[model samples]
Target: MKKSPLYLSILSVFLIAAPFILTARYTQHVLIVVLLYVALGSAWNILGGFAGQLSLGHAAFFGIGAYTAAIIASKTAFSPWWALIAGPAAVLPVALLVGWICFRLRGPYFTLATIAVGEVVRLIALNWTTLTGGAVGVVIRPSLLSGTSKLPYYYVVLVIAVVTVTLCHLMSRRKLGYYLMAIREDEETAESIGIDTTSYKLRALALSAALTAMAGAFYANYFLFVDTTTVLPLALSVEIVLIAIIGGLGTVAGPVLGAVLLKLSSEIFRNEFAQANLLIYGALLVLVILFMPDGLMGGFRRLFGVGARKSQRVSA
Candidate 1:
């Protein structure tokens, strides 16, 4: 299928006018969540997709970003918006440490390291009463737009989502993106070609971590709360991966599409199958993975035959 900017332009205009089109607060809420998930999924894709490093522990960076902002807002006089910078900034060192350790391993070993590290972070958040407020969680001071209108929050998150996609698109068009894909497809070959596999992977991780942290901090302030289980759970990490994978890996539109499908399915399943939501959810994931291994976007591409005739079309 030939890629065109028309679809993106239309989508952007529709989203921008969504407030006017869908006035219901509930609808706005759903869309907001979708946007947030898109950002989170895109962030994960930086490492998981292009870099070929599937990180199942992104929740650690996410939770840390949430707590850092919430804590600063609750305990100090600083604005929660500080988290936009502080969140990603704070995650830098953690990303470095994690990359240093996990990058030492390869394949499933690296994935396992991320899971273990994530679990450790979750546990610390659960037990560390002084900082993270233990299991009680932290209620962040609301952003200035809290009660004013969900519109503001909606736009803010939408911007983050757009920026995330834009950044990933730009990165994929750059040398770094090619290097990451090279590393992902074959690390040995990438290194043999003098791509500096480790260094490039680390760079990808840094960007991925910062983006994840930014999303987490936004989640905290927008919701006015943060909890270890909610923000740091292994399930959350898995969900991020699912979003990227189910939408389409190694593509910019994959995460956004995955977020929309998953979020809609989850909301519907939860409301309609209150008693067996988990069972239904599991079934849905299984079905998606079984039928669409390359993700929904990839499925669409095949169904409509979307691929580069001249080259992989830049427009998704």
Candidate 2:
């Protein structure tokens, strides 16, 4: 029999309470950053993992979202809730346009195109001093309740993290998910099987962009500031991809695992030994990629035969 939802609920309860129970502010902050990357990694997987579209420019959507939310909150008296929608809303058209152009290309070309797009967005954010406050960035006023409290920010990011992961799970099981997977495996074969590969890729890109934008919104609010480097940096995009890759691409839990492991390790390294942390981080990533290209989750599943056994049991 399939595992009961009750078991899953209990697990979730334990996870939610564990951090508070530990009562370590530093640990909580690390967890918050993990949640942020988890959302971003999952969102990136919608295209990179599902559709096999390697978009290195995902930070563009992220930056757009951050800027949109910042602008709305700064200029008007709009509620922070609305800022969430505003960020994703602003990036939709750009995503669609980029999808139209780059989706036509395959493999490395598409990846390069995405990198260029991210750079363009970053440049715009840097130069648009009047609007984006230039490189200095815009500071956000604290929210009404628990101003500057880490707990409130932590919960907000956690909610967005949960929502993002949930959405990715649903998408992976839906028709669109199948279509994207088909294209990922073989575009020509998918087309031969009567799938509209182009349209499906575009759809995946749109969804990925929107979801990533939402993460950006939360990041801006949580940090209470927005800058070109922080929001649209190439390193940020790479970090998201690295998390998904290290976790396990094309699996629901891969990005989550990857994000948590990578972010936690990085944080610990930075805190414990600020010097040579990046070198250590880079070395670890290289090792993971070299030994297990399919990622940590994939290796675990293979080693334990979890996926194979489950499928076999289902078939039986």
Candidate 3:
């Protein structure tokens, strides 16, 4: 706890200086995307990791946020800045509603329901030509970003990522975090102890949805476009979950590590083994899961004997 402030200050300095230090356009773009995933992964971790409610349809909330801002920007001549707030705001009620309905189920049933919700939202975006531009998608005018350089996008996403991670960190240490983790471990036990599992789950989902939505809005602005396929894909949702699970579930820094590893590895695979990239990528993920069921953090702890030391201390 004493070193936290120092570590945070260092991290902030590095993030702020990253765009200038990287210099290369492609590197900056990749960094922006990495930060985006960091935010997305952490947001998903709030519910999926801490609360144990596996949502296979978070892309629905994400797409809603992107679509909300895109539709609003396309209609009005206002600046895209409004989306930083409006996007998440639009998603809040929908998340609550979804939670209210889906929380009634347990385990895989809840997961399946989320998948259905995501597909439903995607289909709506695909067919609703008048509102969302249908399959044609909505393209942002030049007025949206105001520049060709990636620095603005980089900084915006950086801030979002930092805020999202910070919130997740804070939440994990508070009552909500404990309640959600209790739910994740054993819902009936948590309920027996007077923890309102449903209510805490809803809160986790709402927080997760808003942060995911914010990232979605950034996706629209950075990519300068939005479509059902791009914003609301099952693949995207899966990637978000993989980031959390692969990095370290229920750990604050895990998503950041996971995002970096996944994004960079995918980029490498695409460039080096263009034809067999998907195969290699899937195999790599499998290997990681098989060897390190608790993810990279667990592997690191075991390798460094951190777990052994902790056990020894507990025994002592």
lDDT of 2 at 108: 100
lDDT of 3 at 247: 88
Candidate 2, 1-316: lDDT as tens digits: 2554697689678667867775787777787888889999999999999899999999999999888878877788975546678888888999999998898789999999999999999998899888889988999877754364477777778888888888877777678877888899999999998999988998899889998998898887777789997899999999999999999887778999899889988988888889989998999999999887789876787777776423112222
Model 2 alpha-carbon miss at residue 107, Å:
0.6
> Model 2 compared with the native: what TM-score?
0.93
Predict model 3's lDDT versus the native. 0.88
Runs of candidate 1 with Cα error greater than 4 angstroms are 1-4, 308-316
Residue 256 in model 1: lDDT: 86
After superposition, the stretches of candidate 3 with alpha carbons farther than 4 Å from their true spots are 5-7, 307-316
Error of 3 at 35 (Å): 0.4
The candidate, 1 or 2, that scores higher on TM-score is 1
lDDT of 1 by residue, 172-262 (tens): 8778888898999998899899999888999999999999999998899888889987899999999999999998888888898899989
Ranking by lDDT: 1, 3, 2
Root-mean-square deviation of candidate 3: 2.8
TM-score of each: 0.95, 0.93, 0.94
